[model samples]
Target: MPDARLVDSKASFASFSNVLDARLLRALADLGFARPTLVQSKAIPLALENRDILARARTGSGKTAAYCIPVVQKILNNTAASSSDSQSTRALILVPTRELSEQISAHLRGLVTYCDKEVTIANVSSGTTHHLQRTLLSDKPDIVVATPSKALALLQSKANTTLVIDEADLILSYGHDEDVRQIFSSGYLPKVYQSFLMSATMTDDVEQLKGLALRSPVILKLEEDEDEAANLTQYSVRCSEVDKFLLIYVILKLRLIKGKCIIFVNDVDRCYRLKLFLEQFSIKSCVLNSELPLNSRYHVVQEFNKGVYEYIIASDESIKKGEQDVESEEEDAAETKDDNCDQSKSRKRKHRHKGEGDKEYGVTRGVDFVDVSCVVNFDLPPSSRSYTHRVGRTARAGRSGMSLSFVVPEKEWGKNKVVGCVESTKKDEKISARIEAEQAARGSKIKEYKFDMKQVEAFRYRMEDALRAVTRSAVREARIKELKTEILNSDKLKAHFEDNPLDLEYLRHDKPLHPARVQSHMKHVPKYMLPKIAPVAGAEAPADSVAQDVGFVPFKKGGDRGRGRGRGRGRGGKKKSDPLKKFGR
Candidate 1:
């Protein structure tokens, strides 16, 4: 029950020299890590002493490196001390998702960059064939990363001396509790191995896991300081179903938002639907969900971090709902049945295989998206916890970020049945209120953003045009089509992509899924449609800069070529009366 505040804030990497190996120190320095994070400073020392640990820290707070450094250090020390061939799996790190397994493995590789020959690692949840994975496990790598179900079948656990369950709060919700029980209860490890359970939040499920895995462990609850919490600005805007599309189109197409953004939806169909709608406007964004191959999803995140893509339309469908959620959804279905029987059946059919999506795929929590400038909740999440994880993707590592959520009024739910999500939308006001209270309890404020929707009414036609093009048939087709394409890219053509670097660059995830009609005019905003307050290219600030207070959207007037350039003259050199030059007067 130790509060993390008592931990020494001035603890430095040099202080760990007594406990850490020299090679590990050199590797950390090579990675440009000057000082240890708070969790790292506290956990590393205890972990080095072989103490079982249950630690909680915020996301992107270097939790991965905290445990990894100690584990790698221990293995390095053991290899030096042992005389014989000590070629056995010494550590097992379990995660909730394949993406996280790969992430941890990559970080481990960096930590062992200078000592690669001495330590080896494998990821059993990498979507490779079990035969291939079994073959890989036969080498007895020093470290193994996997999800619980994957490890239950392939792991020979007698030789392992250390176990780590990353994202401990999520593992049980993903329906891995049984697999975990089977692994630990059925003689999966040595009797005296050290254990580490690391997570961003602690819940009853995590408390239960402490009993199953850890001994009398050191519990470290690291609370975020005020300065770190202040880095995020949360905003909520209430809009109709159609207005959500119009506002997002205006926000993105007008270049109001700066840097990379992640748009989160509640359902898989909504993910493809928003992507296809944006595609009509030629906005380049990749889709991430459980339906795609794990390798392709990892590649999408890699490309985004490398600045290859600016936006990612993701659905947190992989986040398993709790028992309360199940009961509420059943109630919502019954309510919908009386109002519209046919729509309820359609919704039921759409979700007949809801649980069939990859249980081991998660994006809202464990999967890190680097330098995310903003998070747009295209659909309100079902719970306050889900809301926290969605916004947590940004405002990380002391970086300032914004989260803008769209809340549908109770009166406006299911107005346009096409883009409507009945289950998640029906209680938008309630969910938003809960979210506000939760944030307020944490000393954070979620301001009600007052956006003048009338100013951007001009974009409604374009939104409508694009929305019509993305029909139900079109969305279904795009989903099937993208899955096939990603399968080819991830599995069938694995060797081909490995050999051809240029071809890999050309094989983009954001390519247009164009089963719908391509409205070329929608791609470019017309000059006459510019809002009066938006800044024109090469123009000074407008007199009414009140809109600047909105903060999330910096309205810039782009896409105009001749305005305020060359004396507003056309190609024929005729001095034309430029309407944009008169804007904001």
Candidate 2:
């Protein structure tokens, strides 16, 4: 909105592109980068001049090259420095994920490759052989790209003259904010050196980053376009717990919003369970959690990067510990009892976490993915804040995204059991209080929907009927207009209609309008779902949809799904059914 060149190019971007150090430009050409993105064009020039910058931009915006080109330019172009005493790492680039670190390192190599200067890069992604690190650090690298844990450990082992933080917000939000500070605590880099914190969102922690990390800094924020949501279309479905996975299976089969998706959840175990469930559907998926070793986590991330895994399920705790919900004793006790009752059924429901809200789910928190398009919250988020974040994962980077949150009106937040009313978080409290006050002032009506569990499918069918009725009425109203117009023109509207008796309304959408009435199963069903059953009927999703899944793994092999196995755990070499297994039989 402000009057500022988003990119630094004053005239033609080509002018500067042509002027780039020959080696760097050659590398750019090799990488197929002809022109710079708006952020890159603006940020790179300043960085080349050693004028520290703070520019805001989204991922896939070419920010990496914007900074990388100039830094590599300095390293390769340094003619005054002598090789004899010219030691110590000249630049350090740190990132949140090992995959990201590897990605940056890969690009850095390309950019520096064209240079005649013999420069070495130290890559500190997870599971790097210790012997390799010892050799590189002692021999000395001109550049180092690493994750905080590995980089910090390496720097602790020795010292670095320079450092950089790629996803600064991740470090802060993930309970590793202190670790970042500690990485610099050794006073390795100069106090006045440059530090970059890159991310799409501008949370308060991002705005406050410089105070703790850098000196007076330059700040540039790139606003997402007004049409960012143009490509995404959203919908919410309510379903029974038993039908939830089936619904996901159906959607994946449809492949409507295809490509890789990062499934978010609040719990780690559920992430693995969902991963396994998705695998059962023959979908490629992987899981991310704190319990797994760094290498295993790295493997999952790498698999995703390589397109080997199209789905990743992870928790909010790993993203940012304090922001998510802790599994209280109540949930554990209930889960334990259910597990003891029947292990198979319990396993089916294991990762499902049917009615639990986003607080306990990972995708409900602030972390986001690169190019996801659809966010599906199998269960609703606990509050609007969680809901806002969950759905925000998709339709990103100047593209459109959609969110779908599942609600089953009959069940409480935990299950079919009538758990006491769920307590609202600070965010929900604010929303509820503000809504009530606004309603009282305007004398507007409100609807409440209560939760019910058993009749979920039945209620879903009822709401489908009502929605169909409304849609039919709308169609009839349109026909009435045409008939009246025909009468005025003295033309035969009925003759044309009879000739084409197809259902025009059904042709409007691909998926059928059968979301299973969410109102019928709510602990406090909102009036919108079923005026009588709604806990709060007038409430609308603040954004659009909520996100729920973030981890993926395989729970069953293909043979288990075969009809020949005849259900009941399937294919354990059972004898033909006698229709009776009694003692006499």
Q: Work out the TM-score per prediction.
A: 0.87, 0.58
In TM-score terms, candidate 2 sits at: 0.58
- Counting clashing residue pairs in each candidate, in order, gives 0, 67
Candidate 2, residues 1-585: lDDT per residue as tens digits?
112233346454445644466666767777767667677777766666556566666544566776777667666555345556656677888776654665677778888886635567878664447777767777668788876666666773333433456655554655556666776676656656666666555566666665655565567687444343333334444454435544455345334345666655544444443444443334545555544444334434544545565666655443224332233234446655544333454445444644332221222332335546456665444433344455556544445445554554443233422111112211223343333353344332222212233323333443333323333234334334422332432222223324553522221111112222223232222333221211223554233221211101011111221121101111242422211111010
Question: Which 10 consecutive positions of candidate 1 have the poorest summed lDDT?
Answer: 576-585
Instruction: Give lDDT tens digits, candidate 1, residues 1-585.
Output: 223334454666665676777788888888767788888988987887889999999887889988999899889889988998858999999998888998889889988988999999999999789999999999999999999999999967599999999999888888788999899889988888999999988788899999999999999999788867866777788889888998899888876667789999877888889999999999989999888888789989989988899999998763244512444567667776466664666567657966656778888877778878779999888877788888999877767677889999988877786665546677889779888987999898886665655667777877887898889999999999999999888873357776776676776889888988987878777666766544546877756543443322223233333322112222243543322221111
Best by lDDT: 1
What is the C-alpha local distance difference test score of each model? 0.80, 0.48
Query: How well does candidate 1 score on lDDT at residue 369?
Result: 88
Most TM-score-accurate candidate: 1
